[model samples]
Target: MSSDPRIRLSGVEHTFEGRSGRVQALDRIDLTIEPGEFVSVVGASGCGKTTLLRLIAGFVHASTGTVEVDGECGVVFQRPSLYPWLSVAGNVEFGLKMRRVPRKERRETARRYLDLVGLGEFADAAPYELSGGMQQRCQIARVLATEPPTVLMDEPFGALDALTRENLQAELRRIAKERTVLFVTHSVEEAVLLSTRVLVMSPRPGKIVLDLPIETDPAQDLDTLRTSPAVLAATEKVRDHVQRRTPLRQA
Candidate 1:
């Protein structure tokens, strides 16, 4: 892993004007993501994990402080959001096309990433023809095709069944071995399985409650790792922190 910080957030805050009043979504957030690091953000619902992702993606501006993303970033949301009319390879090349990459280079890069995600054979397939898992793989290929130094994922596999989610989680772990990834998810198991560092956020006005390092071997199988004592201990620590911050009514 590189020693330099790939992304930095200092005193980041955001609020929205709701019918009731102004509601704070994030507060005083300070984070640093290092090059080639895999970090997971976990918290209860409404903790602004997605908001933080949007801020980093440049979709939304920070309300209070600075968000400095040094390298290019690719984002994947909960849904694949692939265009049905586009072939798998076409979809993967969409970003490159938008950036006006040469057609030859676009096709070459698209094929490389599709193969990387085990979708090379599906290059000509349409989104509708794919299973949920396959479509997510295409989406990942699309993101990887951008060749960004950092990837931001917001609950990318949250909608999948347990089996599919587990499968993709393993694939994601493999991908993270080659790139910097910042993923947000509510699943404690997913966080423990894929993260180098897990950031636990507090509820409402989200803040980092704990930034815990995950020390297990990154090469361990997801199933075996989840059952390990170290993984269980980390999960419990995160669960306790989130529970302490959650209101009794919600708990």
Candidate 2:
């Protein structure tokens, strides 16, 4: 893997032309994600959490400041954007195909990621055949098959049921063990559970309000982690910071 910072944003600010006027979505954003760090971004709706993720993913360019990424980047959105015509294996190999990888290697690479995400048995199945959580899992496998050094996630589990969300969180904790991840989510507990560092953002023209380092045992099972006193206390603390900035309706 490369030695450079996986992601770096310096004095970054983004503005878009709105119906009323130019609206700034992010302001003076400065962040650096080292290789192998899991960073979670939390904010109220309209606070530019998605915008930040998109900026790092290179979907939208920042109006000001430099955003640098040292290696390949992949994104998994809240909604799975799978190809219905393709089978599970095909979907996972799509990026490799785009990169002109040979068919034999593509199939092998796809199988590895599918199995990593616990969907090896569903290789030949259609995307529609899987549940919402399972479909999202396939999306993750597709991104991972590309062997990206950085993964940007826009609340990939936001739409799942509570149980499925928890299960996938555990799966993600395992999959991103070595890569750099920038995750945006509304759930405080989810952020606390999966992140090495958690960032809280302001209401509008979003800026980092708090950047907290989380220290927890990753070896612990999900059930144990959820019930641990330290985890609960950290969850509450992060929740309090968010509640103070986010509107009650959003909270």
Candidate 3:
């Protein structure tokens, strides 16, 4: 990883004004993401992981402090979010088109990334014609075609079945190897599988309680790593932190 920070959050907070009153979603978030590093955020539901992603993507304003991303970013959401009518190549070229990339260069770049994700053959097919996993591959290719220095993924594989999700996770690991990746996920194993560092957040007024480093080769196969003791140990540590931070309900 490069020494330079690609994304930095300093005392960041997010709050919503609800009818019930003020709801604090995140509090005092201080983080730095180095270039070409992969980081995952794991926490209980409604703990503001998605909100953090949005803040980084500039979709939502931070309630306090700074959320800064120094490079261009491409985002992949939980859903494929492709244009159903467009062909796979067209979908991948969408961002480039918006940026006013020349037609021939856009096509070449889209095709290159589609091939990278093993979707070159599907270039002429509509997104609806592909399987769920394939659609996500297309989505990833679309994001990569833009050649962003950073990628922000919000539960991109969360909707897939276990087998498919695992496959995509492997693919994501490969794609994120040279880019700064900030992923939001609830799955402990997912965090273990992809992250170089995992940040665990406390629920409701979420704040980072632990930032655990994961020492493993990103080139390892996901399925093989699934049963590895090191991966299991890291997962257990994250799970324990989450369970410990969860508050018990009053009777």
Candidate 4:
């Protein structure tokens, strides 16, 4: 692996203006994410967690400072974003198709990723035909099919039922082993469970309040890891920074 960071944000800040007035969303965020790390951001609602992801993904530009991503990014939003008219396999192949990849190569790539996400059986199924969880899986497959170096996710499982969310969490953790991921979620436990590092942001005009490392064995099972002392302690620390609005720290 290269020594350089996969993602970096330097003195980053963002603001949004509307009919009402201007609202500052982020403030002085300096972060560095190395390759092959799974990082999660957790904060109170409206704390600009999503904005941070958007900045890195280049969906929105930072009002000041610079945001750098070493390679292309694949973003997965809270809701599944598959085209209704396309079959699951087609949705996965869409990115390759847009790039004009040869038909045979793209189909093979689509099938590979669909199977990786456990959606191979539903390759011919329409988006509406699958349940919410399955639809999300298909969306994830589509993103992975593009083979981006970095993945930015914003509350991808937030709307799912508790059981489904937990299952997907495990699946994501497994799938993220070799991928660089920046995940944003409101759940502290989820952050602790999934991330190699957990970042807590202060309320609106968000700043990094705490940057904590999670030292867990990736090979360990999620259920067992959940109750482990290390995970519990990390969860409490992240929750404290988020709930108490701890002092600012550069991430």
TM-score of each: 0.93, 0.95, 0.94, 0.97
Q: Estimate the lDDT of model 3.
A: 0.89
In terms of lDDT, the poorest run of 10 residues in model 2 is 242-251
Runs off by more than 4 Å, candidate 1: 1-3, 246-251
What lDDT does each candidate get?
0.88, 0.91, 0.89, 0.92
Better of 2 and 4 by lDDT: 4
Clashes of each: 0, 0, 0, 0
- Give candidate 2's error at residue 123 in angstroms: 0.8
Clashes of 2: 0
lDDT of 4: 0.92
Best by lDDT: 4
lDDT of candidate 1 over 12-103, digit per residue (tens): 99998989999999989989988988999989999899999999999999989999998789999899999888999999999999999999
Kindly report which residue stretches of model 4 are placed more than 4 angstroms away from their true locations once superposed. none
Tens-place lDDT per residue, model 3, 1-251, is: 44779999999999999899999999888899899889999989988899999999999999999988887899999999999889999999999999999999999999999988999999999888999999999999999999899999999988889888877887788877789999999899999889999988888888888888898866678878889899999999889887766532211
List candidate 3 segments past 4 Å from native. 1-3, 246-251
- Candidate 4 structure quality by residue, lDDT tens digits, 52-79: 9988988899999999899899999999
Cα miss at 235, model 3 (Å)?
0.9
Best-to-worst TM-score order: 4, 2, 3, 1
List the candidate 2 regions with Cα displacement exceeding 4 Å: 246-251
